[model samples]
Target: MQKLKWGMIGGGEGSQIGPAHRLGALADGHFELAAGALDHRPDAGREYAERLGVAPDRAYGDWTEMLEGEKGRSDRIDLVTIATPNSTHFEITKAFLEAGFNVLCEKPMTMTVEEGEEIVRVAEKTGKICAVNYCYSAYPMVRQARAMVQNGEIGKVRLVVTAFSHGHHGDATDADNPRVRWRYNPEMAGVSGQFADCGIHALHMASFICNDEVATLSADFASTIPSRELEDDAMVNFRMQGGTVGRLWTSSVAIGRQHGFDIQVFGETGGLRWASEQPNQLIYTPVGGRTQIIEKGEGGLHDDAQRLSRVSIAHPEGFPLAVANIYCDLADAIRGEIRDGLPNAADGVRSMSAVHTAVASAKDGGAWKDARPSIFK
Candidate 1:
């Protein structure tokens, strides 16, 4: 297949996410890095973009410059990925979508629910795609889990329990690290920290796998490190619109945990489990049967799972490949193919609503609050 022209904003040199975006976007040969505003600094961004093979003219300084540069080009980029900071997502996504470009924005999508709602409106008005990078949802086994729920293989989902926790920031000494500090600073990370960062991923996973939207939630947040203004740990209890019970725990201070994200779904007739650490397998147990491990590339897997499983069974397709599945879906969507599993602006806004509601609930002593955005409500 011919490659789609792609551009990117942020995810510059030394950025934790930059390499992943580069690798994922190009991995399946669906997209070519044609333009970029890769760094906050003009010279650095231009230099890095050139090193990454973006042409001199297309390697712009910042998002605004890239927007104007790409806007009038005869062969402008078919899509742009916004991997910038959380605060800039709303503005950049809105601008690109309004300019008649498809976008894949990093999660949070926006710092505020209002901003998220506005982006949703703009995308609708412009008839453009505004996808959020909930890439974990694109994992092959996760797709299998979602498929099982939709096919009633697990019966009606009764509950979902999930967590996205890590110990990288547990030490007090790292509290002052610029990378660690900004995540808890209100000015940078916005209203909530761990809950907004890792928690939403888990929450999204629950909604994704259960094929239900979160309706209401109660939460408890803690700033385990006294110096931080936002919570480093959070526990949330939620009810899905379909009455499925949900529980999520996310923390940056859970010592010894590494990329600790996992989810389990309980249903009337069976239970299913999957973890990021073991992305290739889904554990399953029927109401009265032995537990089975469903491998990603095994026979009888759902079409979605099988289609996205690039390698053979027992082989590992890690984080970047999960992200590549997202790009694959985007490429198909851009070509006028309907991909129901692709996460979009609606999903983005819902997550923002949940984050804000969780913040309010945590502050109010874990009082339950509606989690849907006002527009959805």
Candidate 2:
């Protein structure tokens, strides 16, 4: 088993994602860090590299230097993880992919639809593995839900309802909360704002679970918080490919919320429901039967679901483990054992399209359309 030598372009000293990348890459013992371009500031970059245990000289101040060095030491970096702000995702990922290194990027793949679509084209040309981090797909039970939906756990899928909200930064800017200041800025994060931040994750999760394309719908969005230039709430009504109606609500404003996500599906004979806040269980109820709670590592589990229940049932697996699963699956892709699917580049484009459309509608006082599907194309 050849372990992938991994390098990170962001997630340095002050980076929210640096520690996450480290933990996720090491979770399965198949990847090890070799280098990093940790920060925009030279001193900060050097400090971040030292903190991550990279040899001082291998740490570069900018990604360009890291890319040049990695090109020469292809043996040292089989893959690069881009965990930077949204705007930089395009440049850092484009550089590594063009240099023939595989990429596992964070969600909302690019700041713009054009950039997201172009990234997909480049990946195809390079033939390198590319994936976006939509962590919900990594859940053992979520994957189980996906399989059940496809195998007809419900007689025929009819409706999807989703809600995702968090009480975060409604009254503050990244300036007020240093941790989120960058996300508040259009240049650093991109134009979609909160929609790009967490809404994409929910939208992608629904698509993955159902394995169906979202065809058309109308949407409304807003920046409900005072002095915040970006949207804080959004409502999307979707007509899925098979005429399954879906209503998705996303917000960073609903008071006292913390990473809340609940997905429910209705069909002719049964339904599927899962909540992110409680990752270990999936709710299944037959139209005429008692509801079932499908715990992550407990009994009544399918083989595929149990296999991904890598941790003990007694030991809870939360966001970090979920993030690690993305790295794990992408490693499988690099090994030629799988294809990119968990909110990969194409999904990013789709989400961006939806975000842009909702924003456009908001500006136009809530006009809606169908032809504007989510995605870069």
Query: Looking at candidate 2, what is the lDDT of residue 266?
Result: 87
Which lDDT values do the candidates have, in the order given? 0.95, 0.78
Candidate 1 overall lDDT versus native: 0.95
lDDT of model 2, residue 211: 86
Model 2: lDDT equals 0.78
Report the C-alpha lDDT of model 1 over 1-377, residue by residue, as the tens digit: 78999999999999998888889999999999999999999999999999999999999999999999999999999999999999999989999999999999999899999999999999989988899999999999999999999999989999899999999999999899999999999999999999999999999999999989999999999999999999999999999999999999999999999999999999999999999999999999999999999998989999999999998889999999999999999999999996989999999999999999999999999999999999998
Q: Model 2 off-target regions past 4 Å?
A: 171-182, 339-341, 371-377
- Give TM-scores for every candidate, taking all chains together and pairing residue i with residue i: 0.99, 0.93
Clashes of 1: 0
Clashing pairs in 1: none
Among all windows of 10 consecutive residues in model 1, the one with the lowest summed lDDT is 16-25
- Pick the lDDT winner: 1
